[model samples]
Target: MNLQDLQWGLMMMVVGMGTVFALLALLMVVLMGIGRLDRKRPHLPPPPAHEAAPAEATPTVHIVADGLDEDQVAAITVAVMTHAEHRRRLAAPETRAHAPGSQLFASRWLAVGRGRESSPFPRERR
Candidate 1:
């Protein structure tokens, strides 16, 4: 390319890069301003203690298994209880409901297909 063409190319590159950087900087400032505005809003006090619901007692579970011994059954029960407790503690009050079963099944199937058993090449017909 000629010197004029090279100069034009360089000018275009600089202008394009500068525009992107300027937009990013502008976005950062706008986000910070929004955060500040949110922080400045008045805070509401939580409801008094008496209005809160009373804690419920844990329910008993009955399991019937033919082959398992007492120790094995106890271990399974403990594992289940620990898992339930962990889920209760970690779950968020405002979290969305679980996704549909079809979506979950499709995702799991895709995951299994992508696992170690997957082959890069297609199988030939017999």
Candidate 2:
């Protein structure tokens, strides 16, 4: 290539790279300005006084099951506790005692389809 052509290509390359870097720098500055503005704004007001009373902490319950090791028991306990907490949050305060039936001990495979017709992948579909 001629010297002039090479110089022109180099100039174009520099201009393109400079444009990209300028845009990125401008974007960063804009984002930082927005963050500073957000920091300057006042914090949100606290929740209304009527709803401000703290919720009562629920006591932990333990389950003793036969034939389960300590690790299994711990896992089951955590799962049950989390489920109970979730249910309590969703239920009305007046009907809080309504414990749902325990599916924790239920067999998952009992209702699973066992026949060839129940296969997830069928050759015909493929």
Clash number for every model?
Answer: 0, 0
Q: What tens digits encode model 2's per-residue C-alpha lDDT throughout 37-98?
A: 88866779987666533565565445456867667898989998898788768884554554
lDDT of every model, 2 decimals: 0.75, 0.75
Candidate 2 segments exceeding 4 Å error: 40-126
* Candidate number with greatest TM-score: 2
TM-score of 1: 0.32
Superposition error at 104 for model 1 (Å): 34
Q: What is the lDDT of residue 5 in candidate 1?
A: 100
Tally clashes: model 2: 0
lDDT of 1: 0.75
Residues forming the 10-long window of minimal summed lDDT in candidate 2? 108-117
Candidate 1, residues 9-36, lDDT tens digits: the string is: 9999999999999999999999999999
